[model samples]
Target: MSGDEKGPVLQFATFQSSVDEGFWHGLSSLKLNKLKTDETPISIMGFYTPCSNPHVSSHLTLLAESLPTEPSDGLPTATTHGNRNKCSVPGTLYNTNTLEGYQSLDKKGLLQAEGKKIWEDIRSGKAEEDSSVLLRFLVVSFADLKKFHFYYSIAFPAVVLDPPATLVDLRPASEWFTLEEAESVSACCNEWRMSSLTADVPFFLVCISSNSNATIRPLKDFKACQHEDQKILFAFYDPYHGPNNPGWPLRNYLAFISARWNINKVQFLCYRENRGFADLGLSLVGEALIQPSQAWQDEEHVPKVIGWELNKERKVSRRVDLSTSMDPTRMVVSAA
Candidate 1:
C-alpha cells in the first residue's frame, strides 16, 4: 500500500456482466493484464430485476457470460460459471435461440410489446414466466480492497434484449498511442477545438493515472504534496449521444487511488475548471496570447478534458500527444 509499491490501478464502475467476458477479452487482447480480474474493486453500484421464466433466466445467464470477465464479481452465479443448478433458476442461452427470438421479436414487433409485458409481469409476479430478475452492476477497482456492489433498476429496452449487443462488440476508437506519438506531443502546444455533440448533456472526463503509486487524496487535502508524474488515460461521453458515445463513456472514467496509501501526496485527474469560462462570456483572465496558423484554425474534435501529468513542482505534462495523432486536415484534438 506504500507509494512505491503502488502500480497503475484501473478503476471504473461497470455492470458485473461487463467485467466477465467483454472486459477480459479487451484487457487480455490488449495485453493489459496477465490475469483477468486481478484488479481489486474499491466501490460498486448495481441494480437487479428478477426473471419470471426459467428459459428467460437461462438466456440472461448466457447474455451475462457474453460480457467481459474482469468485472464479474457481482453477476449472478449461474451466469458467471455456467452453473445453472446452483441458482434457484438456471439461466442459459443458445445462439440459435437468441437469433430466432430476436428475429421473431423484430418481425412481429413482439420485442417491444413483449418487452413491456415482461416488465409488467416481472414487477407484478403475475406473468407465467419462471422468475423475474433485472440487475445493474457497478464496480470500482483499487490495487487492493476492490469494491463491488449490485442493485435493481427499472428494466429498459436494452435490458430486455438478451446480452445487449453494444457491450459485446466494442472497439477502442484509437489504439494505445505508440511511444513516439506520446513523446512528440509532450512539448507541442497548439490551439485545439472541441465540440460536444450534446451541449445540454454533461460529459465525463476520465483520467487513468500513469503513476502506479498515485493515490487519491481527499479533496480537502489534495493541494499539499507534489510528484505529479502520472500516466493519464482520457475519454469523454454524453449518454444522450444515441446508442453510445463511441468510447467517450470509457474514456471519461476516473480512477481515484486509495488515500490510505499516501496521506500527503493526494492527486486525482479532472477537467480544467476554467474551460467553460467562455460559455459564460467572462472577460479574459489576463493578457491573452493569440497565435494563428492554418493548423490552429482547423476544427479538431478533442475530449472535453486534456490528460496530462502534474509534477510535484506543479508543472503539467501531456500524456497522449494528440498533436501527431490528430487529423491534420481538420486539426481536431479528438480526445474521446
Candidate 2:
C-alpha cells in the first residue's frame, strides 16, 4: 500500500520463546555430570521457521538437540546442521548456581554487553562473513535441581537506532513486485532455501535487474553488487507473518546495514514461506530510511539495546515449574 497506510515508524514483532521438556532434562544432565558449578556461558541453539499461519506467530524454540552433544573441555563441540523445517540460531546460556545470583544479575548491562558483540561484528565485517551472528541471543537461568523449577529470562539483543527507522514504503511482496519480478524472486528464494549450504543462512541479498531477473547472493557478496545496475533488496527469512510489522531480526539487520554500508535508505524483504516454499502473499517488502550517526564511528561506544521478552507488560523474569512432569518420585507416586 503506502507508508502512511502501514504507519510511519516501523514496529517489529518480538519472538515468543518455547522450551521443550527435553531441553530441561538435557540441561540437568550437563549441570550434574559435565558442568558442575560452572557459571561460564554455554553455547546453545534456538530454532524457528517462517510463519505459515495467518492466525499464529512462529516461536524461537529450544529443544534437547539445541545443546552441544559434548562439553568443549579442550575439545571442539559438535553443532547440529539444521534443516528447512527448523533453522538454528546460535545462543548462549548463563546458568547461575543460586537464585540470588540470577536475581542480582545486571539485566540491562548483560543486554548491552551482548548487543555490543553484535555491533562489533557489524563494524568489523564479521556479521557479513557469517550473517547468523546477527541472530545471537542470551539466556540467564537458575535451574533449581532440588525443586525442579527453572527461573529464567531470555534476550534477543537488538542494537537501538537512536532516531529509529522510518518506513518509506511497506506492503506485501506480491504488491511490490510485478508478475515477472515476483516469479524470478520466488524462484531465486526457493533455490536459496532448498540448498543444504544456504538453507540455515538467515540473511542475504537479492539483486533484481531492470529486465526482472533476480539472483540471491550471500551477505558476504554484498560488495559485489555495488556497481550493478540491478535493484538490490536485503532479504532475511522472516519468522513473523504480521500484516504490517516485520520480525525481530530486522533490528540488528538495519544497524548492520547503516553501519557497514552507510546507506541511509534501504529496500528489504521479509521472506516468509508456506509449507517450506516461498509465499509472496505472506511476505512483505519495504523501504526504510535510517540516519547513520557519528556515534557509530567511535569503536568503544555501543548503542543502547531494547530486547527483553516481556511478561504481562512487565520486564520481569519468568519461572517454569516442571516438578510434576519431571520429578521421578512424584511421577512414580502418581502412577501408583
Candidate 3:
C-alpha cells in the first residue's frame, strides 16, 4: 500500500509475428497488379487469439484475408467483428520498393509515429469507445517477387511509462477473489465472452458489488462505473500464459486508465482461458501502482515507445523465403 516501497517492476510478454504464405501471395498479386512500384502505407489487419496452449505462444498473424479486397485509401480495413475465435487488430504495411529502403527506414521514428496515434486515441476517448485501436501495429517490408523472398520487421508499439508500473500484488484470480465473487465473475465473464456483441471486445470494466454480484461493462462506461460503490477492476483479454507477467497490451491500457480516469492505483484482471472456456485459475489478478506524469498532458509530447520484437535476443528484421514451395518453376524442378 505504500508507494514509497516499490514492488517489482511489471514485465509484459511480447507478441511474435507470423505471416501466412497466403498473405505473401496476396501481397504479390496486389503489388504486381494494383500497387506497382508504390511505397504507400496500406491498412492491414492482424489476427490473434488468446493463449490456449501454454507451450505455444499466440502470434499476431497476417493472413491473405488480412489484406483489403480493394486498394486502401489510408483507412483501416474491416475487422473480424463478433468473432471471439479471431480478434482482428489494425496494422499498417509499409512495403518498400527496395530492400535498401526497408533497411534504411527509421524504425524508431516509425514506431513513435504510430505510438502517437495511440496516445491521441487514448486522449480523445477513441480508445475507450473502440479498444481495438490500442493494438495498432506496423510492418515494414520488402517483398522480392523475383526470388519469392520477403523481408519484414514487425513492431507492436507500447507507450513507455517513465517510472514504469509497480506491481503491488499478483496472484491467480481464484486466489484473489472470494469463492462467491469468483463464481459471479466467472458467470458474468462467460456471458460477455459468449455473446456475439461483446466477444471480440478486448477491454472492459468489471464491477463487483459488496454482495459479490459481478457485472462486465464496456470501457466507455468507466465514468458511470466510477459513481457506483462497486469495486472496479480493469479487465482485458490477456493473450499470455506466463506465470508472472501480463501481456504487452497492459502497458497502453494502464496509460489509458491513468490518463482518462486519473486512477494511480489500479486493480486489474488478466483474463485468460483454458480450451476456449474461462479459467479463473489460469487468469490472474494484480494491483499496479502508476505515477502519472504531467508531461503526458502536452499534445506535442510523444511517450517513448517500447515494443520492437527481439529476434534471438537481438533487434533485427526476420527474412522468410518461400521460393521452393510457392514458385511454379521451383515446384516443377522439385517434382521432376
Candidate 4:
C-alpha cells in the first residue's frame, strides 16, 4: 500500500531527569559494567487507533490471534500467601465485541469455540506446564474507549496476574498545581515502590477516567499499581483537552515516574479520529502533536536529551550546563 493508504502514523518525544546526583554518578560508574554485561539499551514502539468504530473488534481479534503462544513449561512457581493457586487458574475467554442481529449469532459461535479450546487446555493441565509463563505474555486492552474494549490476557506459567488492590478517585480536586500535584502524586507512588521492594511479583493500575476537566495529581503522588520492574503502564485519558491543557496529563505522568523511578525515554502511538473535523477538530495538539515532521524524515526518530548541572545544595535551582546524548526509548503511549 502507498504511504497515504498505510493508515495514521504517530510520533513521540521522551525526556529524562534525575533528582539525585548520586543516581547520575552511579550511572556513570556503571559504564564499564554495561560494557561487560553486553546489554544494549532498548526502546518500545506501539500503535494507537480509534476504538469506537465497527472495525475495532476485528482489529483486537486480529492482534490477539497474532500474539505468540506460551511454551509448554510449567507456569511460574510461587510460594506466596492467599491461595496463590487462585491466580494459576486460567482466565476466562471474554467477548467484548458488540454486534447486531445476524452478526451476533455468527460471532458468538466462533468465540465459543475459541473459549472451549482454551478452557480444555487449562483443565487438562497443558497450560500450567511452563515455568516462565507469567513473564511471557502482556495483556493489552483498551479500558476507556468504547470502540475497542477487548482484553488479551496471556496464559503463561511463570506470570501471575493480580487485580487492582486500591482505587484512587481523582475527581475531588478542582484544579492541579504542577509542583504541588507532583508532591501528592509522589506519595501515591510510594505504595508501588514499597510493593516492588517487598513482593517480587509485578502489579498494575488502570486510570479509569483521565480527562482535562478531571483532576490529575503528579504521577509521583499516585500509588504505583504494580511493582517497579514491570514492563507496562497502561494509562488512559479522555481526549477532550485542547492545546491550553496539552501538558496536564503528561506532567502528572512525569510525576509518577519521578518518585523512585528513572524514565530514560518514552514513545507514543496515536490513532487518528476517523470522524470529520466537525466531530473532533482536526487541530494538531496534545498527544497528536508528536507526528514526524517533513524536516526530520517521515520515519520516527529518538529525541535528544538536554542535560543540566545542579546547584551545590543538590537542588535543580539553576542551569549549570547542557549536553545532548542519544538513549534508548523508554515509555510508549498509543493515542487514538
TM-score of each: 0.17, 0.94, 0.95, 0.19
Find the candidate with the highest TM-score and give its number.
3
Model 2, 90-118: lDDT tens per residue?
78888999999999988888888888889
lDDT of 3 by residue, 1-336 (tens): 334687978878887788899999988888898889988888899887766655666778899988877565544455567888778888988999998999899988999999999999998899988998999999899999989999988999899987889999989999999999999999999899899898888899999999999999999988887898999999988888886888888889999898888899999999888888788888889999999887887877878887877788586688889998778999999999
lDDT of 1 by residue, 82-104 (tens): 12111222211111112233223
lDDT of 4 by residue, 146-183 (tens): 22122222211110011101111121111221344333
lDDT of each: 0.22, 0.86, 0.87, 0.23
Count clashes in each candidate, considering only residues at least 3 apart in sequence or on different chains.
Answer: 66, 0, 0, 36
lDDT of 2: 0.86
TM-score of 2: 0.94
**Candidate order by lDDT, highest to lowest?**
3, 2, 4, 1
Best-first order by TM-score: 3, 2, 4, 1
Span of 10 residues, lowest total lDDT, candidate 1: 279-288
Q: What residue runs in model 3 are displaced by over 4 Å at the alpha carbon?
A: 1-4, 71-79
